[model samples]
Target chain A: MSLYIKYPKYLTAGESCVVVEFADEIDRGANDAVMNLKKYLLTQKDISIVECLPTYRSLAVYFDPTVVSADEVINAAKSAPELDGEECASSFTEISIPVCYGGEYGPDIANVAEHAGISEEDVIKRHSSKSCHCYMIGFMPGFAYLGGMDESIATPRLTNPRTVINGGSVGIAGKQTGIYPIDSPGGWQLIGRTPLRLFTPEASRPTLIEAGYEVRFVPVAEEEYKKIEAEVAAGTYKPLITEAK
Target chain B: MELIIRKAGMLTSVQDLGRWGYQSSGVPVAGAMDLPALRIGNVMLGNPEGAAALEVTLLGPEIEVKGTGAAVFAGADLGFSVNGKAVGSWRSVVLKDGDVITFKGPRGKGCRGNLCFAGGVYIPPVMNSCSTYIRAKIGGVEGRALKIGDVIKIGEPAALWKKLEGFCLPEDLDPAQDANAPLAIITGLQEDAFTEEGKKLLFESEYTITAESDRMGCRLEGAKIEHTEKGADIVSDAIPLGAVQIPGHGMPIIMLADRQTTGGYTKIGVLTPLSMEALVQKMPGSKVRFRRADVSEGVAEQMRIKEAVRRAKELRLSHVSRTHSEAPKPLFGHFILTVEGKRYEITCEEI
Candidate 1:
């Protein structure tokens, strides 16, 4: 099931950006045609877009060459219209995510269960069984790159990379996973954490996992991770959402 | 509050001309890494080219003021001074209220500059940006770097404040201030994961800039380039803003302005918002080099720096012979004044 191309290539990311790729393979059908050309260039309000991003199979954009250029964002992304990467995959929104796995919040869960010869409870039951796909949020703010893990609990990533790593911890690396929405300096492999507050930046919508959502995780334990870290610092924990297969 | 820091040199912050629609949430557009010397030092002080100034770095911040405002200082040539009197770099000075100012460090090259103030530098902006992204602390001040006494508040100058002082930057609208020019870029990300001799050893050699460069990237060294056999990682993207990348111990960072909004190596080229505002004013053992441009020469060097800052604010608003328009000869008033009570109305003219 991999058709969807609909013109993508365009490169130049320089004098004001462009990139747009769409597929050189990072799967999920080039990130669902990079989230359907980033929701069709965020509905091209007559093209003046100053940001876009959408990674996992390109998107970048970022315009305003004094108004609009980069050949008008490659002629409005080559006359748009490619759509159907799963027809807005049910206008995305799954959420869930709790995770509290392995001792001391995953110290690389016995090296990812001895590199998958499985045991740490079958590596947390094949990493909280399914449901993942985020495909990019970025390295620092509200992190989240996710994307369906479970390649037999794929691991490998810590060849020495840890000067910090804390905020909502969870990890994985190869075949992707993610979560560390804030402490930083990672290298992945570990796995477990999420007391919520996935980056608040003074609240009112700071970021909790957005890039076509769907997360899922849910495991919780250490006294329900200290009662969902005190109902996420007294704001009454929420993270549950739904709507999407 | 009208500026105060008193001596926070070597890393002053509070920038502007950046922080745009949060890179898909990873933030980090930080701002003012010599963005055309903070938009021509807020277009030589008459403010508004993206206000909130003060970048500095490469040792330079002393400031003191506290009342009388106006300042300008653009990219590099730090020597600056006032209560000690030297006042260099593209005109506009005025300061004076306890004056002070300072900044004498590297007087032979460059390395970030700007200052602009006249009214800007106020603060409180965060998401909509007053710049400063000191590794995600957030916008300016509270987000760190400008310590010493901190004060800083400014904002309220342009009442044509003496035609916003002197205004200079006119040396053929200054170009290659040469901290070793060349930058250019735009080569195409992961250019086939490199190797045509690593794109002829990155546009034929010459690197250097590495005291571990800062504002999130620039780290370089020299000949490494090579890749292909598919190594230097790639599954990451959107680094743009002078990208460059290369990792895998083959060096060639670049990024700039606090970078990292996504990056997993192998970029190859990007540079050109006027080569990242002239390679963030060079200096770190300086010596760059990497030309291959295109994207219409980085959109004609960013429309020739927004047409040299809209022709230096229209030649500082039509040259007005170094400001002096005197014409005040009116005096009339129709009394009716009452303060401590909410009932008063009057009209007058006295200039």
Candidate 2:
């Protein structure tokens, strides 16, 4: 349960940015290290730091060259203390997302089931049974790249991507599964749709899920989905969140 | 001051330096494609370098002014005119109320142009920027491109506006017009992920800008870049503004202002800011060649461009002072004056 990895490589992204890469592959330990370093850097409040973008196994730090040089940023990143395994273990928030599966909400449910050689009910059960950690948020704003999907349910992305996928649609692609936070063209096999607003510029936080958070899907009936949708539209729906043990 | 969009061209939107300090939350830093152009337009009007301006793409918009103000058109030379009469670009022109400003097909090589008023556009800032990210529906006028009949407000002009009128940067200082200019790139990141042949192909061959190019990215179709064992995919990582990412299909995509915050494609290198400035100006079908430049060289080139912009601004200010010896009487106890290309604050009583 201890997710701790050492980042040994740092490369210059450009004249103004530096990328600290943890590992080449996407693993829990690498993601944990990336998230921990990002948290550490933000706390330092370095005047040179303009923005820091954390991904699966790396963090791209954009800085003002006028304020700090690339060598100085790399040196700061190298000297930063690594998080202990225990600290990484407990720093996660578990949020249950209500998803309406099959029929109209999930057009690709049958496709996913056929690919996985399982029934529609089996697909839903497998998807909701396990919790996943957000590795990073990218592609579109608030779109979390999640880890920890059941291998049996893994399905390849659509050969021809749809022109427009609605926001809050839950999708599965290969070993990865995530939700589209905004309406965009995508190739993921969507198995369900979530009623919660994953991204909204009006909100103070803007994005519902951040990197390193834990996510769980809770299958809801059509009536429940409609009720939650209405509440979300009216700004009264509060998402269920609790600290992960 | 106000202006109504009589004919909204292909795409018109308000932009500034960009929306910064929010990329950590997956927000893209969307801004004008040509940063230098945006700055030059603002500088011509005596406005701040980061002031909001209209980014007119391809065919420019037809606008009718409702209040008197000064305006400057910089970057692309899309046949700009005042009521069908041709107007020179890169110079300040005083507008009269009800004057109709319009533009025809591009007369130059660039794809986008920046039109800035004496006072900046007055749209409320979103995430501390007025730049529009149309894909996400954030910033600018209702987070979308300007349509016909959309009226935009302009901020109050500077006290030195009368003197600053007709100010123009020397013709030699204009942005270079080279459709086939080589873009300087700094190799790093996933450069090793590509095959030696791939790297050679990128530098040796000329790529044509396809019609699929947009604010998000400039997708080029040329000699396919072959990847090594990595095969063009990597653990998703944050993308810099001018990252040259090669997808599985082998075509290189130069990420731009509205690019996603992160991507999984293997990026061979990143273009220098100056190179990106020049690259963005090229329209579809324009040919581009890449040249590897040392990091120090790229940085020095950018510094040189910045200095050029600074010098041009100084020249404009000097022209204003030389042409107008008598400064206007102080208005509202404030005497604003420009000296040595710097704005000075002096009370009317002190003056």
The candidates score, on chain A by TM-score, as follows: 0.36, 0.92
Scanning candidate 2 chain B in windows of ten residues, the lowest lDDT window is: B323-332
In the range A1-245, model 2's lDDT, one tens digit per residue, is 32333445889877888999888888788888888888777777664798888888888898866567788888888777976878779768998999999988999999999998999999999999999999888877788888898889999999999999999999999988999998989999999999999988766788899888899999999999999999999999999999855
The numbered model that scores best in lDDT is 2
TM-score of each: 0.36, 0.90
Deviation of model 2 at B267, angstroms: 1.4
* Residue-level lDDT tens digits of model 2 in B291-312: 9976676566556666667876
Give me the displacement of residue B10 in model 2, in angstroms: 2.6
DockQ of 1: 0.28
**In every candidate, how many clashes are there?**
0, 0
